[model samples]
Target: MAAGKQVMVIGADDSEESHYALEWTLDHFFKPFGGDTAPFKLIIVHAKPSVSSVVGFVGTGAGVLPIVDADLKKMAARVTEKAKEFCASKSVTDVVVEVMEGDARNVLCEAAERHQASILVVGSHGYGAIKRAFLGSVSDYCAHQAHCSVMIVKKPKTQH
Candidate 1:
């Protein structure tokens, strides 16, 4: 937490697109100018879906709740580790990683407000309009709800 530096909140998940967003942010914002001492304080947030939300109806899957919960916990750990490792690899170790439980849309917006962020970065999943309508878009919600400016980093289509 560097004094006088603006805070940047980056939304991370167990997705390749999110990793690209992290890498892209480091390269463009932290790498070129900041080096070891970045101008902006970085906070990486990973939203863990609530067990009930993941279980949905939970009738037939009720018995597997424990299993699902364990899996989710493991995933969260992996996400946090990956984020930390990636930041370390880029020599940007002055980072705060948060794994909160809730919907990503709300979690990211809350993080931006909590940290008084100057910018919020998220990866675009590139879902079609129909799919986005049904699945909802975290990036879209954050763009409109976050207190600070939002950056939706879309991975190159050819990269994968």
Candidate 2:
């Protein structure tokens, strides 16, 4: 939000890979100098899928709608809270966290455009070719569709 500082959008979720990306971004871009101020204004975006999307056309009926919606809401809240807590632990307080309802690829691209971001960061799940083809990689989508530069952080397999 500060003048002269470009915005950086980070796509986060309830996954260790996503958390790794956030940590990588903070270390590489925000914590280098151990300064409170970062070169970019960070905007963390978490995509929360809608109940209808989760339910699909299975026709499980209205009985399952409320429960599914509640679960989704709770999950979104947890993701955002975890992100905020991680940032706090890193001593990075200047950030805006948002939980938008939609698919991750769309939500991340939209957040970058909405924030006029200079860069968008997302984590890679390191899925195999078949899995990626089936799941439709969100990072791959944003890399091509986003208006700004994109960074896909891959967590090392042996980092456990």
Candidate 3:
């Protein structure tokens, strides 16, 4: 693996599965290639729903829109902090945390392309075939569309 390669980790709503995937990438991929001798750049991407969707549904009528700006900022900050911690633990010197507004899959793929990422890492929700067919899966789309390699970390299943 080449040093200083760009790796992009797609983060969701801070779910346990996403956290696990982040940790796994840090442990297995970033840490191995990140240090004084082996330096790598890590970019954490968090996708928020686009405001256009909301505006499209709800017209700009004269009404007091409950702007939860503080909440959004807090959530973004939390994600950034978590990503920072992971990078720090793995000794990744160059790290960036980006909170973008768009659909998850589209944002992730776009970021991967824009960054010319060597690899894209994302968490799998483990939705069944039916669910995936109906709702689509970000990991699946990214794996197919990304210009670079893609890694998906799925949550451990419970033993029945």
TM-score, one value per model: 0.94, 0.95, 0.79
lDDT of 2 at 53: 90
Off by over 4 Å in 3: 1-6, 33-39, 52-70
Report the C-alpha lDDT of model 3 over 74-93, residue by residue, as the tens digit.
77788778777766776775
Q: Choose 1 or 2, whichever is better by TM-score.
A: 2
User: What TM-score would you give candidate 3 relative to the actual structure?
Assistant: 0.79
Model 1, runs deviating above 4 Å: 57-62
Ranking by TM-score: 2, 1, 3
The candidate 1 region of ten consecutive residues with least summed lDDT is: 54-63
Candidate 3, position 120, lDDT = 84
C-alpha RMSD in Å of predicted model 3 compared with the true structure: 3.2
Candidate 2's C-alpha lDDT? 0.92
Give RMSD (Å) of candidate 1 vs. truth: 1.7
lDDT of 1 by residue, 47-92 (tens): 9998888888565465788988899999999999999999999888
Task: Rank the models by lDDT, top first.
Answer: 1, 2, 3
